[model samples]
Target: MNVETITKTLNSLDQLQRNTAIQSDLFSIEQTSDLTVAAALVKTLENLGVRYAFGLFGGGITPFIASLEQSSIEVLQFRHEAGAAFAAIESYFASGHPVVVFSTTGPGITNALTGLFAARWEGAKVIFVSPCTSATQRGRWAFQETSQYTMSNTGIFTSGTLFHYATTVECNSELSEIARRLALGVGKLGGFVAHISIPRTIQTSLLTTPLPHVNFSPTLVTAGEDTISKCLQLLCEAPFAIWVGFGAKDAALEIRQLAERTGAAVMSSARGKGIFPEDHPQFVGVTGFGGQNSVLKYMQEQRPLRVLVLGTKLGEFTSFWNPVMVPSRGFVHVDIDPEVPGAAYPYAETFSVQSDIGAFVRAILKYFPEISRSSSVLPLPRPEREVIKSHLEGLVRPEFLMDAIQRVIVENSDAIIMTEAGNSFAWGTNILRFAAPGRYRVSTGFGSMGHAGTGILGAALARNRKAVAILGDGAMLMNNEITTAVKHKIPAVWIVLNDARYNMCDQGMNMEGFHNVDAEIPSPDFVMIARGMGADGIRVSRECDLEAALEKALALTIPFVVDVIIDPTRPAPIGSRINSLIFHGK
Candidate 1:
């Protein structure tokens, strides 16, 4: 053999060895041109700490999903696209990391929209990936067509109300910029929802250059020194009350300190429960939606001169924008979103401060005088701790059920407690008291029916611990991922409030003076359904069995369900919601 032939043979041997190594080892994102666009994107997401991908796979997205399987990222196939999207959102909260939601063409894209909207409203970092029709196939009556000719590109493929950042990848060159944008988005303050739609052809195309290396430096939006000083001055001007929201959850410790230091009464939004210890001496009550009457009583009897609002919009659900919630002087509102400070009650006086809730609270803590730590001497209003004992042989009352949960789940296990919208939300928010943050979650913003029911799987899988969801029968029937949980062996528990009707609607109609609304649903045996899905379950008809069933569910390693036959006649603590509706109509 000649010298040229010998050199060519050596290069071919090196290439074969490299290919063999690649096949034997796990997939790596070391800037290799040998990777397909889909593989490159998957690797980039893994680098950015995306550990899970939730979706319903289809032919169009097979390449991306397949790439995910090759990497360390766990790809979870859900029963429905919406369930997958909801799961993605909760996983981020449970794990404190970004997650991915993938879908295929047309119907798949539309199916995931509701959950994606919830993800945005609840403030979660979710990266959505989908496959659209190729350029050549556009408008050719292609199956499940997803192109400009067949669908609107305005919001789905572009950044708008639906997505914080969005784009469609038509070529290999866009991968670098796309990766960079994703890194920056997930690292930005608050929620960042992004969409990257790739054509079927580009997913399989080989990369020309290595994907760019990007660093995620999460930007903490803290108030400047001048802003902090102004906030200090306003806070000290009078006796102020601290209004906590879900946004201020990270500042739980600091909020407690501040509240104690200033002798300020602490109250939380419906979704903001547990951010401040509900049993604290200074805690007044929860506000809005399924709020307690204690809050209104506190506002009426001992109204603060100025309210210090932390990380809440004070929207209709949080405040009802009721004049009662308004302080005598005004509000000193601080939130990451600059617009939220005065938007709820624009006519009212507000000293708006835009900053991260936790950081801002820490700043305020430092400026407090040492003497203020002993200032909590005045009498304060406390939330009503109504106790109702379980009967020996009657249907399970919602209050009795909540009491059982507070003992069996809330105090016993570290499981994250979630409540679905409607009566379950009403009961949970009104009754269940938590002492710490991150132990409770409720979607009051979008208030989607099936979020908690479906989201529990993701929460369990991401946290690698038990996550329990309390939902009504309608929500359980609407959307759930029990089979998915069984498939993944995720430790999730569902506590179903089986009332055989849409109780919230049923009760609300009666309160509204409307008669005989068709809100009833034929109750299915949720235990049987769970068994069919390869999970264990228990049905509780009498209130006496409630705690035992909950304990059994929590002790099990597999996904479990506890179905309590709730009494439909018993009204939920939704008087506030009914009153709000009455006010809105007027």
Candidate 2:
């Protein structure tokens, strides 16, 4: 049979097996009688491959916590709700699976907003379980009541702003629907966040019927014959480049092959780092903050005829919506999300395709010519290593610290690196190199400050590998989850750049010709604080001491912190940000 026929037969058999397995699992669950609403919910989560639940306990969620205790899911309790939520987000990033975050009503739910916003913006799959006051306690102002119809009108949960699917389960019969929705949400492309608020009364309600079967497999969209023909025709012509984003992460191998076969240069968004090996000859450089000037220069000079944009919106941060980067012949945009194609470059000549990035790339490969070897174009010359190193000197230059961290990362290639918002993220993204996908995580979408510090624990747990968080002093003070990491004995290393200032804002203000006195702040000795929190701590002030400190931190069995005093006078390289802010006033 031909390739298309074989593919269709295999897909059909796969669906048949999945359906049979679901039926068998449901039959087995039907024999169990100890199932309540809470137990059913936990079972659904377990079947969906949820292995971790990160959150704090409260009276409203007592029943759900008890259910989790009896299941295989490991419950990680955090001191704050936001930390738990951030941990859940990172867990999703590491595992590519949805993680559960539980919180009680009122204050607990409110506190988790920031983390949930971060998750939503970064496109991580998370299931948030919040127990609200019982249905009978409606307008009585019960303690920590957060019902939609209550006096406070806590409608934000279902406002459609933060979550892909949000609902209140007032009846026990809604568990099956909730399970199905959760599965669908988790299976969707680009990830999704789901919120299921169960009333206290419903938690204890008995389920009389057998749990419904939920088998959800995401649809893989492929380019149509006509679209494929058009793409092949366009790609066969010379003078084209490829722009990759986080959404194209799953298709890395195909992307690399396509780049090599077509002799096209490749550039990536910050979130898309490591999707294509940054050191490869075809890779131009990363775009956006902490990005390289070489890629911009290459684009300006080469001015390729066509640009193939894979699974990216080309948002303001990635493209700065600059006319110079848009290319002369416009772009051919391919993405799973139907609306993302023309969202950013509406005025440019665009060919939009709504398809799964991987499937589309594989389809393109089917039509691609088979050559003995790759014929990638000549790579642009990079800046001299000595010149780059000279600018990175000093005891606390951000570049110096990044270089030291990169060395340690090279030694422990399996270790995951997380960077917080601000100069740490800027310098790390620009300087550090990731050789594999999912080894680098950052919060560029929401740009939340404390994310890396708090999220590292979950990432380490999810991957069962050492996690290093590069964070700024301002963010470290704002919301470090060092205590949580210590409490769980998670292997996390915090490399704090102690600049004693909100450096990104400070530098941005200076670049914009404004002097803001509030940017400066006192730097606390993080070693003392980390030691006080029952974790290993080290302070490094001299340039000679950085490598040793990093090695020591990475060798620790428990959580560790390294505090390096950075020079505040050395401005962070944020030229792109300054220009964008000046022109766009974002």
Candidate 3:
């Protein structure tokens, strides 16, 4: 089995045969002799539908990086390991496909932990590939040694909370088992994060055994007929409200239909924006952190009998476990993971159902009559929109900037919008309105500062269209991949709120009666940084220039940046955050 012969054979196959060979039971053919462990692993990942690989190339992980370059998977060399991991997570969300994040050992491995943890928390399918020290160099302090002697092998190299499945490839014999485990893990419902670490020597070792043949079929959990009937009965018994989360994104259509049929007031978690059209008549405002005051008003006034929770864990960021959100009849919560339903609101009576959000919703839709009529005529609360006129001289207001973005970006284009953690998240969640799913992405679960600033490149690349990232200056300065984006000519637009401070912390401190918090930073000219990195950029100091700057950034074919100098004095809508902090005695 020579390399040239294998290439010729693959090239000679018909399109149908090639598709079948690559997608179904890829390892059944005799193809191990010509491939090394790294090459075999790359092929396996490609067969598993991994289209992109992002990471920094180091000596330890050179073999895998080289293999990735040779394969059909698009490879990107990021500026930082954490940025690469964040990009990998966004790539999955954008393409609805699993992505690979590669790294070297020791420091590279450690730097990528934050993004990997976020990938798990965000419920994404991401495979982490890295290299470790060889068995012979256990005690000796090799440069950046990653072995039992230097690093803790418990969570990094072994299966635990960090990864759904993890292992170190010690020999060629373990390749089949590893491939099998990965196939199963990725095929299952919900997020799957797996890590494979190979020693530098073992990476290039010729495979002795063939990779396992896996006929992988995705496992979709769906509710039974009885369960659907029970849920329907609960809904019809009394007035109910619909609460949408990020996990129910795929089921947006069904959720919308359900809401319309029941005439139920709908509210979404911060990350769950756009699942149901925010402008719909039955729509309420977003709930939880950076949420609207309208939601609280609706809860106090309308008081639905039971709330139907979809796909969210009702965590602190979404629910704050606020007693006001709890209804009289309790919750009929649905999620793929059974543990999630009761864990968020343990005291509340919850009827838990373990099922895929879309499948369950589709099943419920099937039971409905063909000519479905509205169930109620109660007037619902709608999210408030304020019209603010710009001032003559001072720095730009965030509200004015958001208004421009909403009109220019959200209303005009189909580009995905992402927001970084901090005041940026609060502003975007509170102001920007979306009417469709797959257009908004946020990481409330992990809430990493630089996640969006660095991840927008991957999102834009994967979506094959423009993607906008709204981030604070702290995040822009902390971590960004503008250089990598310029090199690849990715159509990513970064809108940085250049207020020269960690405004969220600053504002929160003021509200909490803290003085002189020192959360300020001397901000840099982000436009100059973009220009230096070979990307185009614009700076907006007045509210009048925001729409034009946004339009200019969106029109650019290459990577672009829009830096907005905002007024830090105007407090963001973070009163709920301060209340939550005070409630917890922080």
Candidate 4:
């Protein structure tokens, strides 16, 4: 058949298949006499599997909050709107379910900008709901007014920079379309943030018609036969490695199978840690700032002929965009987003295939049996595990802290480990060995401080697992949601590495041969702060007291904080990137 006829036939078949599936999945609308817009909104969200809504309550959003109180969805109140938004994002990360975040008006929505930005950057699925000035009193300077029609430079939320879909619902008729958009946004692959602003007047409006249920069944994108053939041809040539990213989290089993079948050495981006078992013989270390040197050495010395880039953008933090990390031969890139293939490294020869990571891996697995006997590729040599048990001296060192945490994790294998940006992330990513996916959570793309401090609460609640948030003293002081955790009775352990300064910044300046005094900052006793917040607290300054304190913290039913005074003089483990940061500018 001709290309045009073939394409037409395939399109018709796809539409027919979708129609058949939709017929089965469609929900019958049950008409209710007294369904307000607020109730309809909450019911739609509940139908979409949203169980929790995090935010502060205010007069502007009183109706919506009241409706939520009547619904099955649980409302989690936070001191700050940003904390609530961050918590929702983290919850989505843990559960793979989009959560709702609310804000009042004007400043409430603006305060949530940072968290929303981080959510967008990390590709987290979050629905942001906020109240706007009443449609009747929009331009006449209403109380806490936040209407795009009246405010100046207020387009940030709706500017498409932070949200996949942003809309202000002024009428009851818009709710159905809004519900459909939200369902579609959440159903799509990768993270998406949707913002819906409901005017105060519309919240109490009675919905005349029954709310329509959206039929959401995302079709899996798989590699075509031609793409598979090309990939197979590339794999037939040995000495190729696989690079995995956070997008490949669901394809862990298939990834492992592919690596073993081809005898390919596997490395991962920082966010991709624990996707493939790091302890496996075929596993090379992570690629990034806090990455393993042995992996870099392997890439430098035993240069791979080609690389199969799986679901990673290979951005500045991942590859540093340096030639040293980029394979000399070329790369075959696979990603869910069609635009992400050659975005980072356009200079290199990139064979791009847009497909879901799991489906793509499974597709590649089918061809593995055919070429299994013919492929004679060998895995890279295993890197030596650096023993740092004896490195514990007078003051608590970063390495010693990592070792202790590793020991604690080994004992409590089910606990989810999280880290804030800076030294905490570097130490955790480098030292902590996660055997499975969903155990290690870190926000490296946005790299926002105080993210884990608040985000851990949502993660703990979502996973129903003990969450250990290892963060810097600065981050802990910035926005610790310990109060929220305590209020909700979440089992969260906060390990504060208190160096009495922004150690990452201080060390970076020192490495660059520049002396900056602004890096040093006074830190309050976190133990006392935790106790003040109605949570248990412990102070551990010595190395010997570390593991015991961790054990005690882990056993606590409520939120607990372990404040460890780390040595400020000791440098953070920021491998080769120091020179790159210093000399690249010169």
Give lDDT: candidate 4, residue 296: 82
Best by lDDT: 1
Instruction: Give the distance in Å from residue 501's predicted Cα in candidate 4 to where it truly belongs.
Output: 0.2
- Assess the local accuracy of residue 137 in candidate 1 as a C-alpha lDDT between 0 and 100: 89
Provide the RMSD of all predictions against the true structure, rounded to 1 decimal: 12.9, 4.4, 9.5, 4.2
lDDT for residue 360 in candidate 4, whole number 0-100:
81
In TM-score terms, candidate 2 sits at 0.92
Window of ten residues with lowest summed lDDT in model 2: 16-25
Residue 254 lDDT in candidate 2 = 96
Mind giving the per-residue lDDT tens digits that candidate 1 earns over 113-202?
999999999999999999999999898989999999989999899999999999999889889888888888877778999999999899
- Spell out the clash pairs found in candidate 3: none
Query: Model 3's lDDT to the true fold?
Result: 0.87
**Superposition error at 125 for model 3 (Å):** 0.7
The residue pairs in collision within model 4 are 123-191
> Please, what is the TM-score per model?
0.94, 0.92, 0.94, 0.93
Across 303-348, the per-residue lDDT of candidate 4 in tens digits comes to 7888999989998778877787777678999997889888888898
Provide the lDDT at 585 for model 2. 75
Q: What's the CA error at residue 251 for candidate 1, in Å?
A: 1.2
Q: Where in model 2 is the C-alpha error above 4 Å?
A: 1-28, 31-33, 149-155, 370-394
lDDT of 4: 0.82
| Model 1 spans > 4 angstroms off | 1-31, 372-377
Q: What is the C-alpha lDDT of each candidate?
A: 0.88, 0.81, 0.87, 0.82
